[model samples]
Target: MSTVIAYVDGFNLYYGMRAKYGHRYYWLDLAALVRRVRPQDSLVGVRYFTAPVRGEPAAAANQSVYLDALAAHSPAEVETVLGRFAAKRLRCKTCRGPLTCACTPPVSHRTYEEKATDVAIGARLVEDSALRASDVALIVSADTDLVPAIEAAQRLDPARAIYMALPPGHMRPSRHFSTVGYFNINESALRACQLPALVKDAVSGAVYARPAKWH
Candidate 1:
């Protein structure tokens, strides 16, 4: 059996799912989803890279619960690696001022970028590929920034398979890079692989309820 290790871009998957299906399938089971998508391969692990939601208490609470649920999930070995959000000031091209200055169009506004996640994923992927930790590396994301890492991994292990996997509902493929292959997870998998409404933490035995808003 070919060993497969999945690297998931949590935000990318989240926004895409929200845009396409709303919160109906937010309580997802990462392992089962992977199994549904790659039934023939032996999955070894799943690395989930994400950041704590900021400026939204309800959203952050829900995300925390979901992360805990993933931690307690017995069927899959999932590791949650948190990155961070960095603020960057936006300025109008013409006025070079804040949005208040009022440009004709395309007003500037403060925005935050997710930091460290891509780098962490890239470094880990390259290391794992170089070490031959698994026979296949499954990267799930639409970000083109990952192109260089994927290419480097391929160069490191020419015989190993490196697949660029798009999460369910992602129609457009990243035009930046080529890999050994590309895979698209379907909506059925996302719908069918939801976690239980009440998940008990495997370590603390604390029960977490699904967010009311999610229902």
Candidate 2:
């Protein structure tokens, strides 16, 4: 059996799901979802890369709960790797005005961008390939930035199978790299792989519940 490690780009997947399917699918079971997508392989591990919400208290709360639930249920098979959020100033396209614009904005607005998520996913993909951690790497992302990493992994081991599981609503493949085959995340799969409303850790008796808003 081929051993598989799944690298999930959390922000990319989140936005894709939100754009097409909304928040109902947010309470996902990471390991179960990977297994559902790649049933032929032996799922060895899942690495979820994301950045914590900066100012949005509700988002942060929901994310915290979800992460805890994943850990509580699949501590051995799943890992959450966090990135940081950076605030950048928005500029006008026509005049290149810095935040302060006469047309729409009196001042520049701050938009938070997720940092290091793609890099983390890419690095892990290459690292896993180099270390022979798995026979295949299943990437759950649509970001083109990860193409370099996939290319590098192929260079390290041409025999290794690299597959892309595009998030919901994403149709285009990576411009720099190509996989053996790519699959789309469908609503049926997401619905079937959802975590229960609550999960509890037997060792510590800690309970993690899904946020009602996410449903």
Leading candidate by TM-score: 2
Clashing pairs in 2: 99-108
lDDT of 2 by residue, 53-147 (tens): 98799899999889988989999999999999999788878887776656553656778888889888988998888999999899898888888
- What is the total number of backbone clashes in candidate 1? 0
lDDT values, one for every candidate: 0.83, 0.88
- What is the Cα-based lDDT of residue 2 in candidate 1? 90
Give TM-scores for every candidate, taking all chains together and pairing residue i with residue i: 0.90, 0.93
Kindly provide the TM-score of model 1 when superposed on the true structure, using C-alpha atoms.
Answer: 0.90
Q: Which residue ranges in model 2 land beyond 4 Å of their true spot? A: 100-108
